[model samples]
Target: RIGELFEETNGYVYINLQLASYINDILTFLFAFCCFFGTIKLIRLCRFNQRLNLFIQTLQYAGKELISFAMMFSIVFISFICLFYLLFVSKLDACSTLLKTSQMLFEMSLMKFDAHELSGAAPFLGPFCLSLFIILVVFVCISMFITIISDSFRRARKNINNDQEIFSYMLNKFQRWTGLKKANEEERYALIRLEYFDPIEGFPERVDQLLDAINRLYMTQISERSRMEKDEF
Candidate 1:
């Protein structure tokens, strides 16, 4: 059918052009989404990155809250959708169908909705409902959503497992393999002797200063006693 469209035809063609076009569109849509999801899956391979790992951990911590938030959002959104659809179905083209109504509401939530048409339709109720939706969904619900993610991120950062060393090891190995970084003697020896080394230093600068002070005091006392004995003799 697509081939015939390219060729010069003089006769009456009984081709269902819409069918082929629709089929092509559906395939294109599926291909686009498949590519998107495949790219998202590849993120798991790069989890050695600290920022990416932290983001994943944050999501994991917020999973339950997000699910519940989704449910609450859907309920409120659907209620508004149905209400808008029923009230403005005959008056506004944007609310003529469920899909259009939902899309229009989403646009409203994003503050991209053109309210002139709606206001022209219902005069008072249109502006009132729009204000109500912005307050309830955009301000309140979205704010709660942000708060949930923020709290979860804070918790995740605080409670993150001490796998940072492992991630750093992976990154270093990868860099060395890619020739982006080289393994120096110090790093190599430190890596090898990591298990045998103590993480804390036994003698700090403060302890060294204290020892020097004690030695100076002892020397001063001894010299003073010798001077007094020599004077007495």
Candidate 2:
């Protein structure tokens, strides 16, 4: 698209671009996508990593909520786009076209819009609509979107498996097997006591600790009255 636009256009006397002229641009675009896919592949390869795995879990868990939000947002966003394009199409250059109006409104939602440019077009309707957009779209809709994602993220983080524990377990195992495990990490290891550190000893795995922790958290809190009665008795 960019190459087509940058092509020679002298009063519609279009001139074909030489391969050498736009080849660099074509290569750059291809390389950009290559890097992008490569990065995604790297992330996929390390999907077992703690934070990355959590983020993946969050998106998976929040799929329904995100889809609903996207639907609602599209309706509201498109409505405002038409509203702005209709009201300011003759006045404001930014809202001159449907696409431009949408772009401007997206910028507005991000708080990147210029109020002066909008207000200068239609003094009354411009500021009025701008303020309305700021209040409803920027504040209300965007905030709701954020709230939904955050709530979903909270649920995801809470329910997601603790991959960090698994990663640590694997790392420690590798280190131990290679005789490269650090003393500090050995000290931090709860599986085996420092005094009882031996290859022959019965070692409790990190998975057992993780299971116990999950059981503790999964159980409901004890009643205060029951505890008080037990203490009194």
Candidate 3:
């Protein structure tokens, strides 16, 4: 029945490969547009919060470290491919070309290739050499990659904490200058919440209040000084 319907409708019931390709292209464009729009909004939101901004900066630095690690890994991987080809090129019929050799080595590193295939290719010592390659690639190299990523994450976290400490120190200085008491736990929580809001809209009122308090304190001190001087005369 399905074949009869297709024959009757001249295959119009199903989408052709070209139509599917067009649909895929349109969907990809829409996805890209959404990602670009979302990124802009996220950046605007980050600007309102010191902690978020610092986190983004730390992430950027960590990305640079990851990119460097990737470059080094590529070099090492290619070197291993060349070394494997040189060692077994004559014995292995599959590794007739550099590309084929790289593919074979990559598969072996993932433990997907058959051990017997290596033995068949290079009978006497193939198994031992392949084991060494697996240990070097899968164990040592992969572990180093994970360690590099872990170190980058730790560094990013440390930098973020340092930035927060500096911000807290500055906030304390401002409180002292305004003759205000140290912020209580609740006030600190509120300040943290305020960091996510529009700085220009919400921050100025608090600053203005502090400045008014400072002015009042200064005027009272001046009046007290003048009164004492008059009494002495």
TM-score computed on alpha carbons, candidate 3: 0.42
- Model 1, span 122-221: residue lDDT tens: 9998999999999999999999999999999999889777567797878789999999999999987887887575535645766988999999999999
TM-scores of the candidates in the order shown: 0.61, 0.62, 0.42
- Residue pairs clashing, model 1: none
Q: Of the candidates numbered 1 and 2, which has the greater TM-score value?
A: 2
lDDT (Cα, tens digit) per residue for candidate 2, span 1-233: 54555565534655556875789789999999999999887877676787788788778877888898889989988889989999888988888889888888989887887799877888898889988888988888889988877887898778878667888878878897798976475465754664565643544676677888887765634466567789999
Cα RMSD of all models vs. native, in order, equals 15.8, 19.2, 14.3
- Model 2: residues >4 Å from true position, as ranges? 1-41, 183-233
Better of 1 and 3 by TM-score: 1
Q: Point out the worst 10-residue segment of candidate 2 by lDDT.
A: 2-11
Top lDDT prediction, candidate number: 1
* Model 3 stretches astray by more than 4 angstroms: 1-59, 62-72, 158-233
What order do candidates take by lDDT, descending?
1, 2, 3
* Pairs clashing within candidate 3: none
Model 3, total clashes: 0
